[model samples]
Target: MTAALASENLASADAAIHLGNVSKVFGKEGADGSYRAVDRLNLDVARGQMLAILGKTGCGKSTIFNMIAGLTEPTSGTVRVSGKNPFSDFDAFRGKMAIVFQSDRLLPWRTAIQNVQLGLEMLDAPPADRKDTARQWLIKLGLGGHEDDFPHALSGGMRQRVSIARAFATNADILLCDEPFSALDESTAGKLRAEFVRLVKENGKTAVFITHSISEALEIGDRIVVLKRPAMIAYDVSFNTDTSAEERTLIRGRIGEVLAA
Candidate 1:
């Protein structure tokens, strides 16, 4: 590798995402008035780490996701993914990141496998190779037999699975999810959550997701950050992989207390 390329690779390996004293606001502050969505917030998702941001409704959870995904810019401070400004350098993340949303945003015109292949099409992959990759990912996500089905023909949970399949098919180094399973029934959501966590861990993928469900965050997050109004971190914790039932119960109680406060 050239010296510059090697240096860039090293930087990408350092931290998957970082938000340094970031804040965002909308509208005019004095005349039209404005609201601060996030207030001098700072956060980090380390390389290969899965961090969950848990908060109540209207607490700027989606606002934060927007900043991280580079759909919006910070009003002050900085948002960096792999050491690059995600908004200004948006093209830098084309192949390195993918996002899965709560609702399955499948194109109705495309079949399940075709939907998964869309990202590859943007990357200029040959049709046959894209087909193979999409099929493998669908199989991995337990949608093997449904590849030819249209979105309307599948259940809600099945469509969500296809969404996840599309995100994973690109083999992106980073994944950003916004309450991806929130629309499913309890049982279906539980199963998909387990599958999501498994694939992420097994692939050593770095991920950031936001959720309102405390239990879901506890189940999937290696690190959890609780945010309140204006999006300040109220509780930050790291969980051990081997945590006992009793300890989890205690942790749950503590998180509840903070959320209620």
Candidate 2:
């Protein structure tokens, strides 16, 4: 790999995503109109770190991811990838990141490998190189045999896997996942979660995941950040050390308390 690839790998191992004093407001200001989706949110996601944002519905978790993906602009503050603002120059910012939304958003007519190649297509990567890169990721995600299968032919879990492979195929340093595994069955979801963690670790990609399941968050997050009603960061907990069985139970209890408060 070249020096740039080496730096991408190294950065992915440390801190790849950062949100500083960020705030977002929707609608007009007046007695009749106004809503603050995010409020002065300050968070630092180290490269290679897997951070999960847990909150009740409508707590602005998705909004935060949107800002990071440059899909929506922050009303105030900033979102940075490698110290550059994602909002100021979205194209450049996006070159360093990829987002997997709640929906798979796969092209129905395309085969699994083709869908994975779509990212490279948008970036205008050479045809032969894109094909090789796409196949590599599809195989990495256990979709090697299904490379020629279309979205409709695969199961839900398999489809989601394709989505993930596509995201990683971009080789982006940061991965923004918004409830990507929320729609699957418990067993399937759990399996995918484990696989996701493994992929992040292997690729050294920094990730920010949003989920409503407390168990899911605890299971995969290196750190969990909770958002309370009206959208504010209520608590931030790190789970860097190996978690014991008892510790896992305790963490779940703590998350319950935060949600209940």
Candidate 3:
């Protein structure tokens, strides 16, 4: 095997995610009823690489995530994390991965810091330690002052920041995000994206992010894997650049061509 493949296997044995020829079909049987949301998808994400999956709506990008997250199983083939099947070892697998859904699923009654502490609580960390850790992450995400505020009291962007902080605080090796910045204003989204990219890189965490925004994909991903209609990988492009106005424009043009084609 090549070095990359070998490394992928090792990471899979440790904390990686692998999907082999995975397919998800919805609808009942017997009469033109199968809807293939994901078809023969194959992916190997290493221990610390930030990978992006980009596609239009109904293209099965989120379906792929659902399978990996163990929220849903594939109709065929396999999905594994850290050498363990998510379905068979759901609790163990969940410890190795954290997900931030598009919606900020924060508890309405919980304070921001308490919401961030929830993951640690699930892990059974001591309350003091968990609260301290949660506070640090909230501060990291610029939510220190609002830590006592409830979810409803915060703005949408602030709530999303708390959600992101909570996910990172889990200290899971793999982070899965589904259109996390979609609801934020452009400027706030841009800043959050940059900060998130920095955090992932600094922590050496593996990530599979689903986003419709081409610019967001290019900005955060080490590799952008585009899912065309019917759920096949249409383009897999590597991006290596510091975020800049010129780079953004150039990447936008390239991604436009790929989507247009």
Candidate 2 pairs with clashing backbones: 12-48, 14-46, 14-47, 15-46, 15-47, 16-47
For each candidate in turn, the TM-score is 0.93, 0.90, 0.90
Q: Which stretches of candidate 3 lie over 4 Å from their true place?
A: 1-15, 242-254
Which RMSD values do the candidates have, in order?
4.6, 6.0, 2.9
- Model 1 misses residue 230 by how many Å? 0.4
TM-score of 3: 0.90
Can you give the lDDT of residue 41 in candidate 3? Answer: 85
Between candidates 1 and 2, which one is better according to lDDT? 1
lDDT accuracy of residue 150 in candidate 3? 98
Residue pairs of candidate 1 with colliding backbone atoms: none
Candidates' C-alpha lDDT: 0.91, 0.86, 0.87
> RMSD to the native, candidate 1?
4.6
Candidate whose TM-score is highest: 1
The lDDT leader among the candidates is: 1
**lDDT (10s digit) by residue, model 2, range 1-261:** 999879755653444676767888898644367888888887878877899999999999888888888788888876777777777778795547888889899999999999999999989999999999999998988888899999999999999999999999988888889999989999999988999998888888888999999988987899999998656888888886676878878888988998999
Query: Model 2 TM-score?
Result: 0.90
lDDT of 3 by residue, 24-136 (tens): 88975334967888889878787778999998888888888888888898888989987778876789864478999898999998999999999999999999999999999
